[model samples]
Target chain A: MDVILLQLLNGLDKGSAYALIALGLTLIFGTLGVVNFAHGALFMLGAFCAVTVQRLLSISFETIDPDKVDFLGNPAKVKTPYVESWFGPEMGGAIVDWSVPIAILFAIPIMIAIGFIMERGLIKHFYKRPHADQILVTFGLAIVIQEVIKQFYGANPIPTPAPDAFKGSFDFGVLLGFDPNAVIYPYWRLVYFGFAAIVIAAVFAFLQFTTFGMVVRAGMADRETVGLLGINIDKRFTIMFGIAAAVAGLAGVMYAPINSPNYHMGMDFLVLSFVVVVVGGMGSLPGAVLAGFMLGILESFSSMNVIKSIVPGIDQIIIYLVAIIILLVRPRGLMGRKGVMED
Target chain B: MLGLEKKDTSLLIIVAILTMFAPFILNPFPEGSALAQFNAGYPDLMQRFVIFGIFAIGFNILFGLTGYLSFGHAAFLGIGSYSAVWMFKLLGYNIIPGIVLSVITSGLFALLIGYISLRRSGIYFSILTLAFAQMSFALAYSVLTPLTNGETGLQVYNSDPQYFHSENMPNIPHLFGAKMQGTYSLEMGPWSFDFNTGYYLCAIIMLGMFYLAIRIFRSPFGLMLKAIKTNQTRMNYTGLNPRPYTLAAFVISGMYAGLAGGLMASMDPLAGAERMQWTASGEVVLMTILGGAGTLIGPVLGAGFIKYFENIFSKINDTVLHQWFAFLPDGMENFVITIIHPFVGKGWHLTLGLLFMAVVIFLPGGLVEGGQRITAALRRRAGRSGRSGDDASSTDTTPAE
Candidate 1:
């Protein structure tokens, strides 16, 4: 049915975001053994990176045009973006139009640097503390980060529109022999899903093929043994933390157009992403991705009219209900190893 | 006195005196003075101080004693508020019935949630509780709109069934005929003090709850709870099931949260779903930790400290900052204001977050421990100067685990 297909498409963008955030959370938890409650703040910072890029590109200076007259019969003051003047109107306009993509490049290093500072400055000291303390400290950091963002951007959601090319929806229903409007999907959302798939694949490949990844995986399994083997496993773990931060940041950057970048968007996704990580089995990468998509689809399905009619307001609480049921039924999560935070 | 230990009795008396003379103690600054902005002796804020103190004390009973960090306690508080408002709608504006119903309903809700959530410990327990709370919040915000009144919140209306209503009864929430909002202000010279009936009622309740907390801390059951915190595995091996003890603590804390919520509704006569948000739950946790979790007087102190700062800090703005720094040179004043601007008013949460992190990192034992450390250092100096350090070392008190 077109409805089912449409729902699946509806779920993918959100699912990709959940997968991306949960993957990062699991990475930090796996390598550093720190529950970074501020992980959502990182995702938020990534979206802000796109906002920053767009703002930077559109920096304009006003000039009086002698040929044009204003309504008051004075020479018109025309504003031209610095980028337009520097690169010529056509090229500069295109660059500005694609600021969201341009932000991906800018966000990577910035996010990684942030990750490094966060680990080295703050989270490094909390390694031997209780999990509760880690959570508390990170939670404090999240609040601080959120407040800082709110201070800068104000509390309102800033719309970060995608490129002009990706503005409209693609009629998937027509391609699949259904009516034109039946399976309509946004172009940017499809791009987001494809982008997520590539990133997930690249991360998997890097882990599977690289020696550094092997060492990190070994360290994850047994830190002491890796340390005993003369490997600087701690340093590798830190880099992995940066990578995880980059992944989450990229997710945020791409997600800017789908939903306006709000200061609290990170927190809104955070609770659910955490649920995703737990349901996927903590420290399990594949499990995080699978659970992310599963929950996302389930969420969309619950929001369907038929489902809502049967269970009123099911959409509001379906994710949490599923998380609760999953947590209760499968205590260790889907792919969690025995004795991994079992106590 | 009152079946309390000597130290606890003194602490209780001190708290009683402080509450009794709060209008004076809290309003040390005279009316219309530069420091008047810092005064928190108003009925609304003073009421909040005791109400939140009760919530934190209850939280401490669970988290401080058992080391089980719950992140869903606000759900109980919200439930209490809703139940209390319902009582006001059904019965008259009497707070007694509302308060009772709130505690009962929240207790039952906590029992159900605790029974399910207590199956796991550590982060899982926290997440489970959080999920349940979020579910409650979502339900209350939407489908349960009829019960919760949705976004408009639950408030008493003229058309509401008030079977016990009388023509002579006060319209506002009251105890018999004593209005909760009734405040008697006394102005003398430059200073003014307000004696609020609602504040006194809340203060009395907070003191009673504080006393109960102290008793719980000192009881055999308290020791058992601490033991569970220490090592549940060892307790299990010793033939003791920690589940029942933990569930009881959870229920008790939930009831405390509910009582606070009920009190809140009784004072304001409205209940909203935002009260159930996780941030509200986190506020209680922050209060307990910032005060010194597990310490008898810490939660109350923490509650007061946070509430006082939140009120004072939020009231400050750019104009207030300029007034304070007007004596400085123009450039210097501007610089100072710029530096201080981000940590006040709308930026209060930033300061709170930074302070919370610092407390967690540098003073895990919280403000109580910090105070104790300072006193010990001062006594050491005094002893060294007076008695050649003979009793200085012996006077050093180790923090309670």
Candidate 2:
């Protein structure tokens, strides 16, 4: 029971990221009628934005120690990082620590702009094209974005540490009157899970409570009729696209500390997310969130050693396997409406 | 004049002669010509061009004709490769049996995959095929490592010991005393012609495939497939069951992929799970589209073009750039070289992506359409007599890939 509980906690954290990204994907697909294959790349870009912010915060002028003497040496030694002096050694160090959390603010506007540019510049022209063409072109765009990132950042994975405050694990079992190690979980991952819940709630509240959100939801259901009523359905759809991109970007920003950011990370998540979207029922937001978390937890549980001893490589492909089964059993997916992606 | 409707029997003779003497025509540049970056003369890449051309041409038979986009076509190619390589390991390098086993094996694999996947049409069919392909990829990567040889891929060794015809064999069997890559060349001032025997073998296969494709394109079955493409429901409502016809078309295309895969193995004798990946599957689709899907010759052209670009693009270096910009200012030239540097080597993907995007955006019908547009424009400028003179032949000039 303890092991299961621990796995469930771990699973929810990872599941939160997957759910957030997939929710954004389903939202975009519902409103735009275009499969955004580059959503994964956008997530990756959001993570990179966190990394960039971290670097910027850490940047400082190097000081030359003129008093120290080394024969024929330039200024004896070059003292690096005036950060120690700018905000004092301790505070300067800690002040620059909130890289990922700070990145949320930076990423939103950037991601929104990127989303708009992507729609207005490239994908807008392809709305009338076949799915194959859309897939190919967006796939090309994904490659271009990934390669550009790789060229700048190299192909290696960059580790983004959470703030010092959330570095340690919390023992939940002891608090609940169980043994100490029974339900220990990382504070940051738990924090991430909570953050995801808040964001998910915020999004739902906005959509269910606000006029803009209502208009978007209305547009998603029947854009043709909305357009007939003299509303610019295209404008709403474009804003919805921007919102979806920002959501995925925010997920990536928080996820930077959870998973080390890498260039090809986007491609890795792409196929799986598509499977998630399909499994949840295409264009279904709540279904995407539910299915994403369910599959993530299932995948985590499947990877347990005891489970692996039987299926051998079940962990590597459980999501896809489950996706296939669900798609077969329910052709419309868990909550798919009629005639979505039917053709 | 090569009339559009004429049954040109000489086309066969020409193809045969060309295949027989491909090496002599292909290998003239002595390894340093401007076009030296491109020597279809190399047996491995050349065999790839023709064989994959055959594969894409076969794919065109289904997708181009029936308008059914089966995303899992690479499964057949993978099966074909696996079977051929297994034959080489179990039997001998006698590619005849290898080719035969691969065709049958891939045909069966296709039969199963197609049968299950074809139950759903449109995007559902595509997703089913994708699921099957991913399943195959995963299985090959992990579960079926015994057969697939896992990540390192299937390879041959010297001590594998030929089970048959071992007496006079030197390593693998060769055709008529000619090794696979044995190049023969002749040179002039700025041009050259060279050839290899294995190229002739591949050319023979390519011509056979092209001819077969043309025949299929003209046949009644082909007409039926096209009808299914235009309206399958109409055909079904009219009392014609489309399943067997589509199944047969699927199997035929799968066999073509198998043949291509077999030829690929025979060229270099290795089969890896990478060939079964979705990306590899996408490449064939891209080739078909780039060359003009449904056109017999277009897919072949696209395959050749992409293969050629892939090989040439990777060879470009800073020295090549400096050579191009030798007359510019040192600082300006250095800047230019640095700017252009990312496009070569590891950055070949950038160039490819740009080119792919451009083609997708503007040339939906592919290069064949571009040719048509140019011809139409030329005819418009050529006065009143240009209408029937060239349009008929121009329109029908698909290479029958």
Best by lDDT: 1
lDDT of 1 by residue, A1-343 (tens): 9999999999999999999999999999999999889999999999999999999999999999999999999999999999999999999999999999999999999999999999989999999999999999999999999999999999999999999999999999999999989999999999999999999999888888999888888999999999999999889999998999999999999999999999999988999999999999989999999999998998998899999999999999998898888888999998887777888
lDDT by residue (tens digit), candidate 2, B1-401: 22213443454456556556655555656557565765665666677778888889889988888877877788888889889888878767777777889899999988987886676666557667777787788888986888888998977766665576465654553543345556665566665665655666777888878777777877889889888887877998999998888889998999999988887777768899989887788788878888887776678778888887788778888887888789899999999999998888788877877777787789877888788779777777775655554545543545332
lDDT of 2: 0.80
State how far residue B309 of model 1 sits from its true place (Å).
0.7
Judge candidate 1 at residue B398 and give its lDDT. 27
Local accuracy by lDDT, each model? 0.93, 0.80
| TM-score of structure candidate 1 | 0.98
How much of the true contact map at the interface does candidate 2 reproduce, as a fraction?
0.44
Give TM per candidate.
Answer: 0.98, 0.90
Top TM-score hit: 1
Off by over 4 Å in 2: A65-86, A172-184, B1-35, B38-40, B158-162, B173-194, B239-241, B384-401
lDDT of 1 by residue, B109-192 (tens): 999999999999999998999999999999999999999999999999999989998989999999999999999999989999
**Cα displacement (Å) at residue B10, model 1:** 0.7
